[model samples]
Target: MSKSPIHPVSSLDRQSELENSPAQLISLDRVSFGYSHKRLVLQDLDLEIKQGEFLTLLGPSGCGKSTILNLIAGFYKPLLGRVTHGGEDIKGPSARRGVVFQSNALFDWMTVEQNVGFGFRFQAVSKHERKKRVETIIALVGLRGNERKYPYQLSGGMRQRVAVARSMVVQPEILLMDEPFAAVDVQTREGLQEELLKLHEQVSGAILFVTHSIEEAVFLSDRIVILDRNLGGIAHDIKIHLPEPRYTAMNRVSDAFNQYRTDLYLKMKAIE
Candidate 1:
């Protein structure tokens, strides 16, 4: 059988591409963090997220994946090293970096449009501008007719869509997603994944996604980083090279797909 047309660029080529690409949006250099200094959750970590890159963190639970996200989000300051955005220290969360959790995190009392436009209202943006932004994002996320529906009235997938619209409506520079599709059923998860890819194309902002599913990582990531549970550091950094319009079902079962999955599975298992 022919190899899947998806081909990963050579390491040298990747390095050149990165060097020529946009500057890093987020960087973690020699970082260490933990609830108590005695037990470091992440140690000597160094990472860079370039603009328009889809980077995924994959590891066993409790390997400090979420901790890394928290650090980048500025929820926790690093015990050592620095977390920087655009070469300056990350002081705290900002609209420049929007976050989406596994839970939809939508306001129950607000309608879909209300929830999406919440940020603008708080900033006292003009009413017309808020409505235009909210409506554009609603249509982008495929939630047009349900603008007035409350969170409780929507399905799990629909609620998640609302959450995404809320984040993107502000045009953030980076999106942080923590297992945002974990709660949905298999079919729903697949659909959300496709939707997210479409949304990424429209926004073109950097993404940092955390997930335990190897399949999920393979499907959505442009680059996958595996954390070593024992050492609390990076175990593997793998780049995905897949054809454009990556959703064809055949791509999931292609030789290249299985190879990527098998390679990651073995690496993760060895860590265990």
Candidate 2:
């Protein structure tokens, strides 16, 4: 049997090709992270996410994908490497980097609008401005009438939307999501995916989404990053040059989609 010609792109070459392009938004350069100087969760990683790009980090548990997210979110300090946002070193969390945690981090005591508007309560925004912000995000996340509703009043998916809305109300420069849809049911998850795509299209902010599901990664990302546990570094970084607004072919189940998913699955398994 003869082997088909593999794509002639090297990982580093692919990375350089992306970096040398005009749209690259964020870059992780020689990033090494650990609790101590020796104990490393992530070892010398370099990744570049383009502007308005939806990039998903896919790997198994303990593969340090979440650790990378934490580093990007400024929740954890990297012992050796630095995180840069648009060419500046990220010293700490900024409103520019919006964060969405796994659990619905909504304010139980606050209504949907209040929760979304809460960021402005301390800021200089006036009462009318706050209401406008809340209203804008409420509509964006499809939670219009639910503004008066509390966290308990909404479904799990709705709660997550509130979380998203709260994060988006401030209109950060980038969005960092850590398995945001993992807790929802399949149907709800699908809907949330669609909602996220719409939001991404409208907002056009760079997104770094972390998920274990290859399908979700394939469905949502402009590119996918797979980290291997052994080195706590990237195993595979694949560019998905599929056409814009992916949800239209969400269920296309094409040779390209399946091939991408299978390759991601295999890389994850190999890491294990």
Candidate 3:
């Protein structure tokens, strides 16, 4: 697989290629994990996240959606099998895999500029390059003027943007988001979802997002995997076929979108 840069393209053009992509950036092979050995949260899970594809995990609570994210993030190890990245074992957290939590996790003491650029401090990048990258990502996330403001001064959406910018500034190969937009208002969450799709287009990295909203999963995902309760593993792995330019409001009301929503909603309700 070539590690070439992804040029900016329309969502319509990108969708076909993303679906056809053969590169597997992350793989979970026969993975089984439990916080306690008495009951496994995820069992015998085999999954693959392709490079540059946006894959969302959807399920009811305690279905191990976040547990799978944590395993890929290397926050926890699978007790029975292994999680691999680029064909190697993922022993621990690496800068190659970025994470965004439900909370923004920004430093209230640090300005937006400082927080976004913080990752560079441990890296070997020069001061000039660090500033350049930070400014570019901040602008990409639509936070150009609020560089000096602290997280306390920003709205929930804006602070989440900063968290996204912070994770994205380092250019991780795959971003693991554990319901990063779940805390915001409905209107703000919709806006953030649009912006996130735009960012994914520009950045061209794989995104593994965990969300409960079937609409959100349908809107943002190229594919969605639903986990079953009681460690039943993946119940349904569906390919989303919504019309391109998926960020628009029209796609939300389209027949294809609603059908997918209805199907997924029924599947989820059945799980509960």
Candidate 4:
């Protein structure tokens, strides 16, 4: 298999690059947020997601991993500091950033093609173009023949595939996934992970994923950030180094993959 075009950068190297690189796609500068004034879930947090990189946020429950993703998605306003995309404030959700929720979020009434092509309904793309785009994305996600099927008829994994295709069909600059595969069985989740990696390569967009699974995080991320609980902010930020074509079965049991998983496990254990 061909080697990955993008290699993971070391933490030190990443810091240096962050200081000088102009490729910062999304940024949270000293952002602080809370549901109630008495307690803050994230306080003065700072993070930068570079262009076309697969970055995952990992930590225990209540660590604000999902909160961070929501902030970037513009679902909530920061109590202090800012969330910016391409140097502009993110006032609200935009097509530039597509989001996949923990649930599949597919429309029960719509067929596979309609659900995947739903985004085009609001856009100005021509009918022929919309059909072409929808068909291509449906096929890309391996749902060609099932175009007429509804979400209720599909399996859990298949439903998630439609959800992914829906978000990706618009070609957003970044995709924010909040435990999107968490609802599936272990075997099915692995299949989705591999498919997601392949899609990421083809889409060439930045991905900011939030998950509690260490193995899943390591397997899919180019870089991983572990959040500290009780608004302690970020605890650890580590880069992953694994061979290209990470979907291969060997990667699951490989030495490098194990090392990263073990290290992350210990770090999260400490946080808990």
Residue pairs with colliding backbones in model 4 are none
Each candidate structure's count of clashing pairs: 0, 0, 0, 0
lDDT-based ranking = 3, 4, 1, 2
Please list all clashing residue pairs in model 1, or write none if there are none.
none
Which one wins by TM-score: 2 or 3?
A: 3
After TM-score superposition, the amount by which residue 79's alpha carbon in candidate 1 deviates from its true location, in angstroms, is: 0.8
Report how far off residue 77 is in candidate 4 (Å).
Answer: 0.5
| Model 2 CA lDDT for position 49 | 74
Candidate 1: lDDT of 152? 95
> Distance from true position, residue 17, model 2, in Å?
13
RMSD of each: 5.1, 7.4, 1.9, 3.7
Return the lDDT, model 1, position 225. 98
Q: Give lDDT per model, in order.
A: 0.85, 0.79, 0.89, 0.87
lDDT by residue (47-111, candidate 2, tens digit) is: 87776667899887877888888888888877776788888888888888899988978889999
Q: Model 1: how far is 141 from its true place, Å?
A: 1.7
At residue 130, give the lDDT of candidate 2.
82
lDDT of 4 by residue, 67-177 (tens): 999999999999999999999999999999999999888899999989998999889999999999898878878888999999999999999999999999898889999
Please give the lDDT score at residue 206 for candidate 3: 90
Best by TM-score: 3
Task: Give the backbone clash total of model 1.
Answer: 0
Give residue 150's lDDT in candidate 4 (0 to 100): 94
